[model samples]
Target: MKVFDIIIQAMLSLRSNLLRSWLTTMGVAVGVFSIIAVMTALQAIDRSVAAGLSSLGANTFEIQKYPAAFFGGHGRNRFINRPDITYEEGLAFKRLMQEEARNIGLKVSRSGNQATYRNRSTNPDVVMVGADENFTAANGFDIQQGRNLVEQDILYARNVILIGHEVYTTLFPQRSDPTEQLLRINDDVYRIIGILARKGAAFGQSQDNLVVIPITRYRAHIDSRQSVGITVEASSRSTYSSTLDQAVGAMRTARGLTIRQENDFELRTNESLVESFRDFRQTISIGAFIISFMALVTAGVGIMNIMLVSVTERTREIGIRKSIGAPGATILQQFLLEALFLSLTGGAIGIMAGTGAGNLIAIAFNLPPILPWLWIGIAIAVCSAIGISFGIFPAYKAASLDPVDALRAR
Candidate 1:
């Protein structure tokens, strides 16, 4: 028989058993759909996370009392016991590394504070950052208007502030120029020296909802607490590893750690953050694969049951074809093709549905949608293998029946 004739026959056989074909297809569809949707969503999340980490700048690392990304119950206690990284220590590090490092910045933050200008008041969720003059260069911040805080501003403990895009809009809506506007943080007046360029959102938080002030002024007048974090930037990408080593050494020495004592500080960068994310991703990937495998196994069993019924119902037709000089291989091929057709059709439908659903979820989360081509291709390939593997026993049973015996049995 011609290849086209076999295909037509297989399709016609499926049409005759419309309900059974659809039920079998649904099994495969459900299995593929579950896996594809998960994989696509994960890919989108990974992309968004990578972008967020890169926003911190290349060749940059932070020295902090506590870990940047941590989980579980002891996190609060960890913060409580960890020694505060003082501004004095940060200044000492800056002076020691001034010749080797490009820029070093000291930073502290206060959240859930309201800012007011005239009668306008901002939401209580604004972040107020106390950072040094080099914070703009070290943390990838750019001034959209006016000027950034300079060395003199830090030395003199000036009360000048740079506002984020969201803060600028909320507090100075009527004013055309924010440079001249005065913003009150908890009733403490600060002159706006600059407006920061919009940095969008990261990890579900708005990056442009902050107000930054000189560290000296912030410690003396506003917070009156020790430093929270210290950021250091390498002069060149090639020196990143060496720079990290130097910073760690300087921190250990400044903190008075002995050779045997473990260092209490944490050093983190974009690459390290990505590594942490990978650990989570790997766990999810394994779980997804196991779930998909189980679903496919169930679908394969359904295909086998349906194919057996098809062979039994078509006994007389098989006898007639074999009596007309059809070979056993031909009978086997026909049954296999029928099974393959059902699985491949189901696989296509599942892929389309999964992609649509996953992209919709990604859009809702304000992240870029992903297609997950690798997973889709793998699903198709596995479906084809399932068809051949599960169809074998039924095909063999039909092929082995003698023409006269099959005809006489009914």
Candidate 2:
């Protein structure tokens, strides 16, 4: 028989047992869906991490008490035991690196503080930061309105504050000028000096829910023991590497670390942050791959069993065809094609369902939808391989059947 005739016959056979065909395809679909959905979500997160580095301004690095991230959630106690980078030490480091760096910012932060403007209030999740004049230049914040914190603000420990876009919007919904307005953070009142530009959400949390005041005032009114984190910006991208190297030495000198002693403080940069996230993504991908492998293997076994049953049910038809001019090769070809068609159909459905489900995460986090083209291609190829691998034995059995015995079985 011609290949076209065999294909037509195979499709007709599947249609004859539509319910069984659909059920059998479901297993393959589920297997495909598991992998595709997980990969899609991971890829979306990967893109988000890269974009979120805008929080760390270009050519900027931070020196703090601990590393930016601790992968696998281990060794937290060991890092916490290290000494804090005191306010005195931060000032010394900034003075030491004054000539080498373009901008240097010192900060300490307290979260879960509410801001009140008249009777209006924000949720108790505002982050109040103690920052110096260089905070804007070093931390990627632009002044949307009013003047930014000047050197005098830090020199005298002024009560002047800079409110983020979200805080301003929450307190005054009418878009009125927030400068000179009294905004209360918990019990203390501060005069709003500037409004920071809007910075959208990162990791599902709004970056704009913030307030900044002079570091000295923060130390006086808030937690005095809190460690200071320092942000440093190079003059240009070309000077970033040299500045980063010099800043470490300057920090070590400021902390009075000898050549034999190990540095206690952590240094962080945008590149370092990306590397940390990459490790996290790899772990998740490995887990998804293992799960997908197991599911696909189970589904493949089910396909083989179903194909074997199909061949047995069609024995008489096979015998009748063999009794005439139909070749065994044609019977084998038809059975294989049927399995291939079934697998491909399931894969198609799975791809669409998985993509839609994964994109839901993007929508929730206000991130752009991502399509994993490489994974889709791999899914198609794997499905084809599974169809051929599992269908072989059943197709061979049907092709090798004895026409005389098959015809007499009824």
Question: TM-scores, in order shown?
Answer: 0.82, 0.90
lDDT of 1: 0.85
CA lDDT, candidate 2, residue 305: 91
Best by TM-score: 2
Best by lDDT: 2
Q: What tens-digit string does per-residue lDDT give for candidate 1 at 1-410?
A: 88788788888988999998998988888888878888888788788787778777788899987666675454678666878888888888787788878988888998998999888899998999998889988988889999999989889988899999999888777647978668899978899999999887665467899999988888988777665688899999999999999998898877778999888888878876787778777888788788878888898899999999998899999999999998988888888988888888788888888888888877887778788999999989999998889888888988898999878756
| Model 1 residue 177 CA deviation in Å | 3.3
Give per-residue CA lDDT, model 2, range 1-410, as digits (tens). Answer: 77788889999999999998898888888888888988888788777776677667778899998887764357788788888999999999988999998999999998999999999999998999999998988888899999999989988999999999999999999999989989999999999999999988765567799999999999988988999999998999999999999998999998999999988888888887887777877888888888878877887888889899998888998999999978999999999998888888888888888888888877777667889999999999999999999999999999999999889866
Weakest ten-residue segment in model 2 by summed lDDT: 69-78
List residue ranges in candidate 1 displaced over 4 A.
Answer: 49-53, 73-80, 110-127, 151-160, 166-176, 182-191, 199-206, 216-227, 320-331, 405-410
CA lDDT of each prediction against the hidden true structure: 0.85, 0.89
Q: How much is the lDDT of residue 374 in candidate 2?
A: 91
Candidate 1 contains a number of clashing pairs equal to: 0
